[model samples]
Target: MIPIKIPREEKLEIIANIQNHFYREMSDEIGDLAAENLLDFMLKELSPHIYNQAIKDARTTVEQKMMALEEDLYALEKPIR
Candidate 1:
């Protein structure tokens, strides 16, 4: 799998959030560079699992829609004389 590359703006936002959470919850001050490194590590470790789950979700949705379409097509069948 290709490495997941987050947009620069979004990455910055997430890093800021991580920094805030550390300060609020852990009472630890994390610098911007530390937060960015942490974000990079998390994305590398977690993105593949997240990507797989998203694909599974999309496949389920498509299967349900296909079933519904089949039912609708069956309802349109003409009765034999």
Candidate 2:
């Protein structure tokens, strides 16, 4: 759960690491079978959990950012404009 904002290229590298370390441990055929199972698990179980958590986190972060932006805008505005 490290929250790091990375560029798209770095994200791909992270994904490659995940696949190489975790998924690639199995044989190709077995990995394919497991991938289908993993996809089903994600759709049925993992996705809801991830989606809900992400939504909650995003809402909080966006709210905080919006408030900060509003404060900055107010500070920057010209009087009686």
Report every candidate's CA lDDT.
0.95, 0.64
Model 1 spans with C-alpha error above 4 angstroms: none
- Model 2 C-alpha lDDT per residue in residues 1-81, reported as the tens digit of each score: 323345767655555554565645753333444544554454566566777899999999999999999999999988894
In TM-score terms, candidate 1 sits at: 0.94
Clashing residue pairs for model 1: none
Tens digits of per-residue lDDT for model 1, 4-81? 888999999999999999999999999999999999899899999999999999999999999999999999999999
Task: Give me the overall lDDT of model 2.
Answer: 0.64
CA RMSD for every model? 0.9, 8.7
lDDT accuracy of residue 56 in candidate 1? 100
lDDT of 1 at 1: 81
TM-score of candidate 2 relative to the true fold: 0.47
Best candidate per TM-score, number?
A: 1
